[model samples]
Structures are given as structure tokens and as C-alpha cells.
Target: MAGSKIVVRFAIIVAIFMMPSLLWAGAMEIESDRMVFQHKSERAEFISNVHLKRDDFELWCDKLLAYYKNSQLDHTEAFGHVRLAQKGITGSSDKAIFDQKNNRLTLIGNAVLEQDGSRITGETIIHDMRNEKTVVQPRKGGRTHMTIESDKAAGTPLPKAAK
Candidate 1:
């Protein structure tokens, strides 16, 4: 009886460790060449060709570190050729940090965001998902740049001028 009880407890612990995503609430999915999870720190590290998807949002990077709080995703840091896409917008950067609790994404190092033939480039870019706001910051001695393509240039019908 005592041995059976120990076996049951071990099986439960193994199941919890094996199905880490089951603890998360959303439909977030992650894939990578290799993954390591540290239960003590509540952290998971994904290495090599990491891909993450949640709803309409998708992210790709060479490596990603995900942190959890109370069995929920707290935040994530991505490194090496970070790329993100969501809601018709695409962005790239050398590194990125996503604060899940705050619904914010910060892109660092040669950050660029593009949509509908328009592009914004800067040293750092902050996207506030909850507020639908984006702010670009320039590196020291540099300037942020943006290019807005006109509707005519994009082959869209121009609005008629009021008479």
C-alpha cells in the first residue's frame, strides 16, 4: 500500500511537469528545437528556432525565455532576430520583451514596425496592446524614422475632395 501511494504521487508530479501548457489559461502554443523548464524559478527556456503563437499574435526568435506566475504566463524575453506579427502589423528587432500582465511589448535594437507599406524604425519601440498605442525612441545621436505611403501610391482609391 505504501509503495502504491508513492507511485501515484510520482505519477501526478510527472504529469504536471509534462503538461506545462495545461496550466496556462489561453490558447498560447510554443515550439522549439529544445526546451528546459525550471520549476523552482517558474521559468522555461526555449532554444533554437523558437516559435510562439497566441490568437492572432505570432513570434519567432532564436531563443525565448518565458516566466510564469501562479501557473500563468507572466512575461517573456526573446533574443536573436526577433520577429512578431499581429493584426496586419509586423515588427522585427534584435531583442524583445513582452510584459503579459501589462499587455506591453518592447522591442530593442534596430526596431522596425511595418504595415500597409508604411514603416517606422527606431532604436527602441514600445507597443501598448491594451491602449493601442506605439512609441518609438531613437538611440543616442540618432533619430527615429517613419515613412507613410499615400493611398494612391498603394493603389487605393483616394477620397474625393469636398466641393
Candidate 2:
């Protein structure tokens, strides 16, 4: 009887130690020929010429990697010729960061963001997708938009927040 009791206690201890891993299917590993992500389960992966449409914003890229934490989207990184089409504006860059939880996007590394035929080039461009505000700062002399294509738009103008 005492031996049986010891065996039962050992089984219970082992189950308790494994409970967390069984309950939360954590850190999903997604790998394809293009992109890879390590996010929790229940998240989706868009890869290999990814096209993501959130409201008015349409993003296309050679590779897109995204993650979700606690059921809320955390971040996304688009690489290798990232292009964005929204309203009358189109932007292209080597890389772009899409922070869904923060409602912002930062285009980096030789980024050219254009709207209504007007374009700006800089090392870093931070856009507040929520308020439609764009801050463009060139590495040296700052930013300049093509006069002929200037939209004179007041806001940065992002799409509706993704749920």
C-alpha cells in the first residue's frame, strides 16, 4: 500500500510540472520558404509575397513576419521591397515595422514614402497610423516633398483599427 501511495504521488507531481505547457500552447513556430514567426498558437502567418489589407491600407512585401501575444497582435516586420498602398499614397522601403498594438508604422533604410505623386526620402519615417500623422526626417538636410505631387493633406490618415 505504501509503495502504491508513493507511485501515485510521483504521478501527480509529474502532471503538475507539465500543466503549464499543456494548458498554454505557447510560442508557435512558423517557417516557410519566405518568413518565419514564433508566436503563440491561434495566430495566423502571412508569408512569401505577403499581402495584408487592414481597412484602407494595403501592404505587400516579399516577406512578412508577425506575432501575437495574449490574443492581441503584437508586431509585424516587412522586408525586401516593402510597399504600401493607401488612399492616394504609395510608399516603398527596404523594411517597415508594423506595430498593431501601438497603432504605428516606421519605415526605415532608404525609405521613399509618396502620396498623390509627392514623395519624400529619408532614413527613418515614423507614421502614426491612428492620427494619420507622418514625421519625416532625412539623415542630413531633412525632408522635401515634390511640389507637383503634394497632397496638402493635414493628417497621416490611417485605416480603421484592426480588431
Candidate 3:
């Protein structure tokens, strides 16, 4: 009975501490298998199948490291099967870094971005969401790649082939 009471108390304490983070983005929530926070570094590391959710976007990764400034999200580094989703857009990469100072997201290793029917792929991609700009770069000696497909091309009825 005493052990169960202690567990309940600990659960309440954790919930209280996590409330502010959940409220950061109008009730944006983050969850993971484990989390470690370092006050001296002003950073928090979430490991194992991390998920982050908010009104405008969602992010998933195997691990995430968030650095805060003034108790606000300054930047983040996500590793292992990083994925980001927003309205009409989806992006994936092996690793991703969000640079708040530059207002850009840098994706590395088999990076890809897809919207509508078009797709952009490369070893590295830098996207500036505020400005709606993207720069794709090759890794080492590789080449950037893109495929643009029109909706009409796939949706239009084809003419019947003559016999």
C-alpha cells in the first residue's frame, strides 16, 4: 500500500512538471520512452520513438534533443528516421536540425520532401519555411534530384489506342 501511494505521488509530480511543456504550443504535446533534462545545458533529450505534436505540425523520430532559450524552443536536433508533417507537405530524413537563428530546417541523409504530386530528394536539404524556399544539395559527389508530376497527367482520361 505504501509503495502504491509513492507511485501515485511521483506520477502527479511528473504531470505537474510536464504541463508547461504541453502548453507551449497551444497544447502541443511531446512523448517518448525516456527523457532526460539538463538544466545547466538548457536542454532536454527525448529518446526512443519520440513524438511531438502541435496545431501546425507534427514530428517523429527515434531521438530528439531540444535546446531552449528563455524557456522557449530555440532549436532542436532529431535523429534516426526523422519525419515532419504539415499542411500539404511531408518531409523525411535520417537526421534533421532545426536552426531557429536562421529559421531553417536542414535535413541530411536520403532527404526527401513531397507535396501534392511533386517530390524533391537529395542527400541534404535546407528549407526556410517562413520564406517558402528550399535548397537541395548533394552529399559528397552525389547529385540533387527532383520529380515534378502534374495532376492532369495522372488524372486525365487517355485516348483509346487504335486497334
Candidate 4:
């Protein structure tokens, strides 16, 4: 009766004290000007200069929605002026989805990806982070374009033999 209620209250207090330790575990750091998290819904929404960072890569967007499973980040959706930058690659798009476990990122709407000064533009682009591979597809009425740049000028000749 009364004893049971008191025991429940003590348990609740202990659980609340442990929350911070369990909040962010084994996941990237996510920051935004505003954020809302609904634990029961397993979703977190962020707006205004949304940013996500994990290791050397970074993602930025106007809005971001993150889904969680067992407190682990499952995936994320970024919308509006999405941008991603990594060591050897950079990308821009209107929208993007980052799959955490698969280490894949898919961008849509005027997607652009650049690597080693080479660029690809299309309606959609899929990048494999682990393998460093990319695929691009055109919109219904558009076409994809890829251009590679040479390091040296075409007219440049090998340097004369060193003295």
C-alpha cells in the first residue's frame, strides 16, 4: 500500500538521475539551434543550423530528423540546403539520408558530389562511405554530368633532366 508507493517513488528518482549517462552513447554529436526529442516516439527533430559530426566528417542542414533504436542512432534525414564534407569528398543536395550502420549516404534534388577535383551532378546521388564509391542518377527530365580534371596542363611538358 503506502510502502509500495514510496518504493516506486524512490525508483523513479534513481532512474532520473541516471538519464544523462545513457542519453548519448556510441553515436555522433548532433547540435542545432532548436531541438525536440520524443522518447516514446523514438524520434528527435532539430532545426536551425542543424549539424552532425562524427570523426572528421560533418553534415549540415536546415532541419534534421534522427531515429533511434535502443538508444542507438538508427538513421537520420536532413532537408533543405544539405551539405556533407569528408576527407576526400564533398557533397551538396536539397535532402539527404544517412544510414548509420550501413555507412551510406543518399542525396536527392540537385545532388552534387566532388572528389579529387572531379565533380558529378545529378538529381540523386548515393555514396558508400566505407568503400568510397558513388553513384548518380538523373531526374525524370534531366541528365547527369560528370567531369574529371587533369592535374597538369595539356601543353605542359616534362621538366628537363636535372643537372
Candidate 5:
């Protein structure tokens, strides 16, 4: 009877530790060819054609490593053919990191962000999700590039110039 009581208490404690993470965000779904979860380290590794979706955001990558703290999402690292989409915006990079605490996404190496026919490319891109701000950084010897579509391109008529 004592051993059973101890086991019940242990189960309750474990559930308590895991509750915060499950409730911190609405829901996060991940699919991968293989997954390895380490409860002691509070990390999960998803390998090969990984797809992750949370709310309206989606990400695809060859490999992803997600870390947790206090049973809540701490951050995630994505590598190889990293691509992300949310709302109408899309981003691609060689590597990316999503910091849950700060609500920021950092894209590194051949980073490109596109939306509504406009595109920005840089060596590094920092997107602050909470602030809805983005910063692009160029490579050491290269320059960041951006292409913005004009109103006319969207079929909006231009105002006539004074005669």
C-alpha cells in the first residue's frame, strides 16, 4: 500500500511538471520521419522531413531540435532547407532559430522573406514576432537585396500627372 501511494504521488508530480508546457501554447503538432525525446534533458529532436505547425504558423525542415524549460517551450533550432510560413508571409533559410521567450525568429545563411510579391534576401534576418518588426543583415562583403512590387503591378491605377 505504501509503494502504491508513492507511485500515485510520483505520477501527480510528473503531470504537474508537464502541464505548463501543454498549456503555454494552444497546440503544436509535429510530424517527422523519426523523433527522439529526452525527458531528462527536456529536449526533443525531430529528424528528416520535419513539419511543425502551431496555430497559424508552419515550418518545414530537415532536422529540428526543440528545448523546454519548466515544461514550457524555451526555443527551437531548425537546420537544412528551413522554411516557414505564417499568414501570407513566407521565409526560407539554411538555418533558423525560434526563441519562444522573446517571440523572435532568427534566420541565418541565405535568408529570404517574401510576402505579397515582395521579397527580401540577406545573410541574416531577425523577425520580432511580438513587435512585428524585421531586420536584415548583409554578408560581410555582400549586400542585402529587396524587391517591392508597385501598386500598378497589383492592378491599381496610378493618378494622372498635372497636364
Candidate 6:
């Protein structure tokens, strides 16, 4: 009877350890040409066609690094030709950061974000998925442009162009 109890206890421990992975089946995985993870306790390196996938978003870049503490993902950074795509929206930049808790994504260095038929280009970009909005700001001496072409105003009065 003692042997049976030991077996049951072992099974329970195994199941408990597996529960987290099963619950977060949608956790993001990143891949790229090169990747490096440096943490206080551990470090990892990766290479070749880096790609990251989560519940709804995917990222492809040249390199990526993930930091951790006590086994929790502290933060993640991607460098060199980073591209992020999700739900028909795509963004490109030199660097990108993903903040898990705040659920925020920030793209920097000559960033361009495109969604539907609209595109925003600037030196910095911030996307707040929780609020469904994006902010783009260009660098100094740069111009921000917004163009809308529609068929509804085929004969509408138009403003004269400044010469």
C-alpha cells in the first residue's frame, strides 16, 4: 500500500509542473538570424531567421534577447530589421521592445507602422493595444503627412495647394 501512495504523489507533482505550460499554450516564441538571452541566473543564444509568435502577434528580426528573474520573463528586445505583424497590421523598425505586464509595444529608429490602408512613418512609434491607438512622431526637421483619398468627395471643394 505504501508503494501505491508514493506513485500517486509522484504523478501529482508531475501534473502540477505541467499545468503552467498547458495554461499558457499561447506564449510567444521568438526566432531570428541571431538571438541572445541574458538573465541574472541564465543565458541563451539563438540564430537564423528569428521569429516570435504569441496569441495574436508575430515578430521576425535579426536578433533578440530575453531577460528573466526567478524564471519570469523580465523583458524582451529585438534588434536589426525588426518587423511585427498582427491582424493585418505590420510595423518595421530598427529596434522593438515588448512589455508583458503593461501590454505595450514600442518601436524606435526609423519606424513605419501600417494598418488597413493607412500608414504612419516616424522616428518613434508607440502602440497601446489596450487602448486601440498608436502615436507616431518624426524626428527633428521632419514633416508628418496624412493623406486620405476617397470617392465620397468626388466634386467637393478642395483647398488650394501652397506654392
For every candidate, C-alpha RMSD to the true structure in Å: 8.6, 15.5, 6.4, 10.4, 8.3, 10.1
Instruction: Give per-model TM-scores.
Output: 0.80, 0.61, 0.75, 0.75, 0.81, 0.68
Pick out the ten consecutive residues of candidate 4 with the lowest summed lDDT: 2-11
C-alpha RMSD (angstroms) for model 6: 10.1
Candidate 6: stretches off by over 4 Å = 1-25, 32-45, 149-163
Which segments of candidate 2 are over 4 A away from where they belong? 1-46, 140-163
**Cα deviation of 34 in candidate 4 (Å)?**
0.5
> Which stretches of candidate 5 lie above 4 Å from their native place?
1-22, 153-163
* Model 1 lDDT tens row, 1-163: 2212111121232248644445344566777777767888878888887888888999999998988776566898999999999999999999999999999999999999999889999999999989989999999999999998877755778689999
lDDT (C-alpha) at residue 118 in model 3: 90
lDDT (tens digit, per residue) of candidate 3 on 9-124: 21222245443443343444677777777766667787887887666887899988878665556788999999999898999999999876677899999999999979999999
Best by TM-score: 5
Candidate 6 structure quality by residue, lDDT tens digits, 43-143: 34444466777768888877666654444455667788899899898889999987766667899898887775677888888888788777887788886
Rank by TM-score, descending?
5, 1, 4, 3, 6, 2
Candidate 6 versus the native: TM-score? 0.68
Q: How accurate is candidate 3 locally (lDDT)?
A: 0.76
Residue 125 local lDDT, model 2: 85
Cα RMSD of predicted structure 4: 10.4
* lDDT of each residue in 53-159, candidate 5, tens digit only: 88899999999898878777789899999999999999999999999899999999999999988999999999998998999999998999999887675577779
TM-score of 5: 0.81
Assess the local accuracy of residue 142 in candidate 5 as a C-alpha lDDT between 0 and 100.
92
Candidate 5 clashes between residue pairs 3 or more apart in a chain or in different chains: none
lDDT tens readout by residue for model 2, 1-163: 2212111121222234333233332222222333322333523445565666665777777767665555445677788888888888888888999887678999987878776656677878889979989887677765644434424476565678989
lDDT of 5: 0.82
Error in Å for residue 71 of model 1: 2.0
How many clashing residue pairs, candidate 1? 0
Model 4 error, position 146 (Å): 0.4
Q: Residue 73 of model 3: what lDDT?
A: 62
